[model samples]
Target: MTSLLEGLEFEHCDAAAARSIRDTVEDIYRRSYVQAIASGDPFDSPSEFMRRFDSYTDPRNRGFAYVIARVDGKPAGQIWGWSLPENARWWTGLNLDIGDDLEEFTAEDGTRTFGLSEIMVCTEYAGRGVARALHDELLGSRTELRATLLVEADNERAYQRYRAWGWHRIGWLRPGWPDAPKFDVLIRDLDLAVNEK
Candidate 1:
């Protein structure tokens, strides 16, 4: 489907291609997250941000995807994610209890779920549907039964957007990383009628 935002274009790139355009992605990140950076947020640190991207697109990675959105042929936003592996520790920090069948329920049979890691829209493009375009295109193309993403617990705007996008909050998680803050873990079931339309 065509992006709703006029003059917007979405292009898919693999992990290597994403790494090649790291600077462009970082530029969008810096602009979209200027407020967080000014607030002394460690996750906004340039080095830390780059490290997070590197971890997502590591050389040994087996599954990953990236989409860069352009407005009038200029980069305006980006989104990317990867399939969760059997060894994935993304849920390790979840402060919730699971019954004895936790392992059986959470086992990754290779394409069970996708983990959406990042989405950023340039400040200049805010409120122009760039983010919704990028986000929908990325998630809609995924084959997994469901998708997951973590957003700051207090980000009301983000929470509203996700909720409006048909995502449901599963629980809260505090990443083990020293600089990471408590985040809400949201899940979007791909098999639902809400996403099918």
Candidate 2:
């Protein structure tokens, strides 16, 4: 199995791959999201998802970076990020509650950049740890000081997995679209010294 994946390759995605991403995202969202947490069935009505995906992946968004994950020559997952506007106008800041102080993590500042991003692995790749692998690859690549993600609190399984990776919840709200209450905030500080290879 390892050998089958040994030859796999990954590359940066382009505008042309938007359709593939849409399809993959739909598949992952379907199998991963539970009705209890999801606003309804957005996958069934793919319009909004497509619109959001297009805008998010638009190349005009400067400093954007997204990578495709391949396994045994098959596209399996993806990891991507972009610059955040100042003061988190684009949410380019890391919201880490280090128990005592509140600090912002940015890409330009030596202080440490934070990625408010996403990583999705198909169920077939679940046990293989592809999601975590993809995450570590991107997070480690640029030496970000911290990272944050929004997830559904009810999805205990995902929450536990994130916790194991040293992530902690910050708070809650109606994020983005579909009008849902995903776990308001979760953060992880990038220990540059420890993560550096």
Candidate 3:
């Protein structure tokens, strides 16, 4: 879906568009790292995380999908995700926005849910509806019926933004990432008939 905010288009990554997707994801992570430090805290990058993270486009990496949001005809944001079957612990690993264990929260109606895993908007586009646009497309297009994203507990700006979109806290941060403060996991239930429609 195209956002009404000027020339913005949301597109999923295909094998042919993998390079563009990789570039956007890499930049997204880099900016996120910088943002953490600028705020007077340090955030750890997973060891060799880039190598493993870039495999999303590999055919062998089944069960995962990636998407990028382009604004003014440039890649401005990206979001990616995977499935979560039952009997898994926490569904989403403690990684930023990673969720393979979505069964932890199930609705009475039985539809499954997952995380936004990774939603990053280019720093230049910050405060625009770009993150929402990118994430809305991610959840709106998912085969699973529900989803959300993780936000650091100290990011007042982002905390407010996620709240405005109607997500609520469902979990807390687990230690391991370098200098990452305790985080609050925010979630949105897409199965709500009013919201889903």
Candidate 4:
């Protein structure tokens, strides 16, 4: 909540039918990640991004949620995630050495452990508190017991911010996707004081 974000508006959308807002969401994604897309990475292609989004929004997907933030009447950022099913493959690609404790992190029925798929703000609005506002607005009402997100290993700035925000680095994972990179997985308890605000 900074002065720059004072005029921002947030909207929650039904994950299964987000088409009405897809254009605005993709616009923010394209503008915010222009550099990555310019590198000719197939994973960053608009179509590829949409394909993943399509799957995440399927009605059969449990605990799915999507949120958008608009600034000056234009999409400035978005955040979305879904609860991890008991058999979710999220841990299959993990490269961490957690041993038997692995079960401790796996989701089960009624566990409400969500996987934070994406969160980003347009580059022009970086550091203006838009990202935080979007994050807070999305998580504040979540009934999940905990949430997880992955940060690129080299993204020192974001990793630091997540850490400072009370997220703990649990392990690493390399997803089976085109041009995917190993990521440091971070977990944050929904009961954390900051998130409770």
Candidate 5:
């Protein structure tokens, strides 16, 4: 499996670069979530995905980073995230009470929390380390104290992968989006020492 990933190439893009490659990113997203889209899930539709993508890549979103991975010069995967602003509504729909302190974690400054919005690998590259590579490449040097993301509760594969990647469930959230499914809110502390290096 490791050998299969030898040709993988990764590119880091800022908000402007992300906008320039909007179509390519959307294509990768659709390919990555082919199954979910086929299931007729409204939330998984291309239009909906682009809606979220636009928000993530918006210039106003501080510290936005998008990483794309390719193999043999073809797009294989992508991962992106941005810092949440002070008093962000990211935790608004939490179904579980994780305490006021935890809820207030993002209240001080926008840089305190990094919100990982999306990470996906094409089906053909699923079992390889493409996803992990994209993930690490994007967050390994982040200056944020912590990072958080939401994953569908029923996505066992991704949930388990996240667990293996050092994330722990903090609570559940059903986003404000119409017909959105409940997602497991996971958080992981980021080691700032990495950025110091």
Candidate 6:
């Protein structure tokens, strides 16, 4: 008997390296979201996804870190994110009712926060812990005060997984894209996480 994780390997990349391997990343994403794409939503299409990937790979997104998981030499999953600039508009459309001032919480000087952009594991690799491995590799070395990510509000499974992994929802956000559904804004304090560990 062989454990799925026994053959797993991880690769870390910067923005330039990530750009160079865009095709592989895109392939993994497509395989991971096959069902979503099958729904006929333009936002879930490969082309639209590439557009977002391009932005994430842009040099302007400083501290961009990408991690890929491989099982038996084949791509299995990926996770990536970057530091948010002071003027970042990531919080613009967030609707928060949590008593805390959103501005103060979101204040960024390119070091205060890390904006996690994407994380996905191919269907064949799901439940094999590849996604969690990629996540830990990418975020474990971050020096930011906290990290934030968006998950589709209705995705109960994913939302619950994130919650169990220490992320808590602070608000809801509807992206500027046409027909974009609302997503829950989840955040995790890196310092606290480290301390608790």
By TM-score, the best candidate is: 6
Worst 10 residues of 5 by lDDT: 188-197
For residue 80, give model 4's deviation from the true position in Å: 0.4
What CA root-mean-square deviation does each model show from the true structure?
Answer: 2.6, 4.5, 5.8, 1.9, 2.4, 1.8
**Model 2, residue 24: C-alpha shift (Å):** 5.9
lDDT of 6 by residue, 60-133 (tens): 76578999988889999999988888877778788885888877877789988898889999999898777766
Cα lDDT over the full model 2: 0.59
* Maximum-lDDT candidate: 6
Note the residue pairs that clash in candidate 1: none
The all-Cα superposition gives candidate 5 an RMSD in Å to the true structure of 2.4
Q: What's the true lDDT of residue 191 in model 6?
A: 72
Writing each residue's lDDT as its tens digit, candidate 2 over 52-155 gives 66777776655456776777666677777655544453332334444534442322442345544667766666657676666666666555566667777777
TM-scores, each model vs. reference: 0.90, 0.70, 0.69, 0.91, 0.91, 0.93
Q: Report the candidate with higher TM-score, 1 versus 5.
A: 5
Please list all clashing residue pairs in model 5, or write none if there are none.
none
Clashing pairs in 4: none
Indicate the residue-level lDDT of 177 in model 3.
41
lDDT of 1: 0.82
Sorted on lDDT, best first, the list reads 6, 5, 1, 4, 3, 2
Lowest summed lDDT over 10 consecutive residues: which window, candidate 6?
Answer: 188-197
lDDT of 3 by residue, 12-118 (tens): 76434654556556766666555553554334453333554654455643445577777777777777765543442333344434554434343223236564556
Residue 104 in model 5: shift from native, Å?
2.6
The model with the greater lDDT, 1 or 6, is 6
lDDT of 3 at 54: 57
